[model samples]
Target: MTAALHGLLTGLTLIIAIGSQNVFVLRQGLRREHVLAVVLVCLASDVVLISAGASGLGALLRAAPQVVAAARWAGVAFLLGYAVLAARRALRGDGGGMEADARGTRTGRGAAVLTALALTWLNPHVYLDTVLLLGSVAASHGEQARLFALGAIGGSALWFTALGFGARRLGTFLRRPRAWRILDGAVAVTMLLVAGMLAAG
Candidate 1:
C-alpha cells in the first residue's frame, strides 16, 4: 500500500479501539447531544496532532522528557476523576435515557463540549497513537509523510463522523436506565484501567 493509504488504515485501526474518547463520543451520540460539536472537536484535534506528529514533533517530545512526565501525571489525575464521575453516574441511575424530561435536557451544550475537550486532550494514549507511533511510521516514507498525515486526517474525520452519527442506531437497546448504567459502568472501568496503565508506565 501507498504511504497515504497505509496511514489511513493505521489511523483507523488505532482509533477504532474502545478508548475513552470513543466511549464519550458514543455516549453523546446516543443522547443526540451536541454530537456535531463533539465530532468537530475530536476531528480537529486529530488533525492538529497528526500534523504535528508528521512534522517531527515526536522527536521534540522525546527531547523533553519533563513535558511527558508532567502530561502523564495530569492525564492520570484527569482520567481517574472521569472514572469516578462515570461510576457515580452509573450508581445514580443517570447518564442514559436521552428522552426529554421536565427540564428539557439533562446535560448542557457547554458541558458536552468541555467533556469532549478533556477526553481528547487529556488522554495519554492519544499522544502515543497519533504522535509517536504515527510520526515514526510517516518518517519511513521520506517526503511523502505529508501525504501520510493527510491520509491519517481523512481516517480520523471519517471515523469520528461514522461513530458520532452511527451510534444513534443503538438507541432502541440503550433507551433503558439499566442499559445506561451498564454503559457507564463499562466506561468507568475503561477509564480506571487506562489510568492505571498510564501511571504504571
Candidate 2:
C-alpha cells in the first residue's frame, strides 16, 4: 500500500510539469479534436515507459552516464528550437495556423494518432521520467514493484483523462484569437523554462 501510494505521488509529480506535449494536448482538448486518440496515446506511452522502468531498465539508465549526457544535450537542443519557433509565432501574433489544415480531411484521424504518438515517443523527458526516475523508485520495492508500476500507470491515465476531457470546458473561451496568442506565448515561456532546467541540471 505504501509503495502504491509512493508510485502514485511520484507519477503525479513527474507528469504535472509543463512542456510542449502538454501544451499540444491542452490545445487539442480545447479544440475538441481527436481527443480520445490523444489521451490514449499519452496514457499508453506512459504505461510502456513506466513498465520498462519497473523491469529494471531504470538502473541501467542511471549507470550509463554517457547516454544520459547525450539525452540531456539532445533535449536541450529540442527545447531551444521549440522555444524559438513558439516565440516566432508569438511575435507574428499568428495563432490562425494552429488549426488543422482542410487539405488533409481524409487522413485527419491517422495524422492525429501519429502526431500524438510522435509527441509522446519523441520527447526525451518521457523516458527520463518513466524509464529512469520512476523505474529507480519502483526497483526499491522488490516484491512490490509490480504494484508500484500499476499505481504509476493509473496515475498517468487519470491525469490525461482529466486534462484532455476537462479542457473542453475552456473551449468556448479559447475560440478567440487573442486566447490563442496568449496560449502560444505561455507555451513559449514554458519551453524556455524547461530548457533552462534541463541545461542547469
Candidate 3:
C-alpha cells in the first residue's frame, strides 16, 4: 500500500507537467475528436511501457549492482536537471500555458490513433520517464515493485481520463499562465524531493 501510494504520487508529479504528448491529448479532448481512441492508445502504451520497466527491465538492473548504482545516480541527475527547468518555467512564465491551436476539420479516428501513438512512442522523454526513471524508482520498492507499478499505472489512468474527458471544463483555467506557474512550481518541488530521495538511497 505504501509503495503503491508513493508510486502514484511520483507518477503524477512526473507526468502532470506540460509536454507535447500532453498538449496533444488536451487538444484532442478540447476538439472532442476521437478522444476515446486517443486516450486508449495512450493508456495502452503506458501499460506496456510501465509493465516492461517494472518487470523485465527492472530484473535486468537488479542483477547488476554497479549498473543500478550508476542508473540511480543518473536518475538523480536527470530529476535535478528537470527540477531546475521546471523551476525556471515557474519563475519565468515561459512555456507556461497551453496555446489555443486553431480548430481545424476533425481528424479521423485512425489518424488520431496514429498521432497519439507517434506522440507517445516517438517521444524520447516518454522512454526516459516511463522506462528508466520509473523503473528505477519502482525497483526501490523491493518486493512491492509490482504494486508500485500498478499505482503508477493508476495515476496515468486517472490523469488521462480526466485530461481527455474534462478538457472542455478545464480549457479556460489550463490556458492561464498562473495555473501553469503553480503546476510547474509543484512539479519543481516534487522533482527535487524525488531527486533527493534517489540520491539518499
Candidate 4:
C-alpha cells in the first residue's frame, strides 16, 4: 500500500508538467481529431516507460554517465527547437484558420500515435523521471517494486484519460484563431523554460 501510494505520487509529479506533448494532446483532443488514438498512444507510452523504470532499466541508465550527459544535451536541443517552432506559430497568430495538411488529416491516427511515442521516447527528462527517480525509489521497496510500478501505470492511465477527455471542452474556447495563438504562445514559453531548467541541471 505504501509503495502504491508512492508510485501514484511520483507519477503525478512527473506527468503534471506542461510540455509540448501535453499541449499537443490537449489541442488535438479539443479539435476532436484522432482523440482516442492520441490518448491510447500517450497512455501506452507512459506504461512502457514506467514499466521499464520499475524493471531496473532506470538503474542501468543512471550507471551510464556518458549516456545521461548526451541525453541531457540532446533534450535541450530538441526543446529549444520545439520552442522556436511554437514561437513562430504564436507570432503568426494563426490557429483554427489553418487546416491540417492532407497527409496529416488523412493519417491523423498514425501521426498522433507516432508523435506520442516519439515525444515520450525522445525526451531525456522522461528517462530521468521514470527510469532514474521512479525506478530508484521503487527499488528500495524490495518486493513491493512491482506493486509500485502498477500504481504508477494506473496513475498514468487515469491522467491521460482525464486530460484527453477534459480537453474536449477547450474546443469551445479555442475555436477562434486568437485563442489558439495565445495558447501557442503559452506553450512556447513553457517549453523554453523547461528546456532551460533541464540544460542547467
Best by the TM-score measure: 1
Off by over 4 Å in 3: 58-104, 170-201
Q: What TM-score do all the candidates reach, one by one?
A: 0.93, 0.81, 0.63, 0.85
Mark the regions of model 2 whose C-alpha exceeds 4 Å error after superposition: 96-124
Expressed as tens digits, the lDDT of each residue in 157-193 for candidate 3 is 9999988999868656667767767766876787677
Residue 190 in candidate 1, Cα distance off native in Å:
1.1
Clashing pairs in 3: none
Candidate 2: tens digits of C-alpha lDDT, residues 26-129:
76777677888888988988988899999988778778867767767776787777678768766776653334344232226676677677556656677788
Cα lDDT of model 4 by residue, 1-201, tens digit: 989988887787788763766876776776667878888888888888888888899878867877778877777787787788778878886544235443243335776687666666667778888778888888888999988988888888888888888987666677676876887788789879878987888
Best by lDDT: 1
Question: Could you give the candidate ranking by TM-score, starting with the highest?
Answer: 1, 4, 2, 3
* Regions of candidate 4 where Cα sits further than 4 Å from its true position: 97-107
Tell me model 4's lDDT, rounded to 2 decimals: 0.76
lDDT by residue for model 1 (102-138), tens: 4354678899889888887777677777898899999
Candidate 1 deviates by what RMSD? Answer: 1.6
What's the best-to-worst order under lDDT? 1, 2, 4, 3
Better candidate number, 2 or 3, judged by TM-score: 2
Candidate-wise lDDT, in order:
0.86, 0.77, 0.74, 0.76
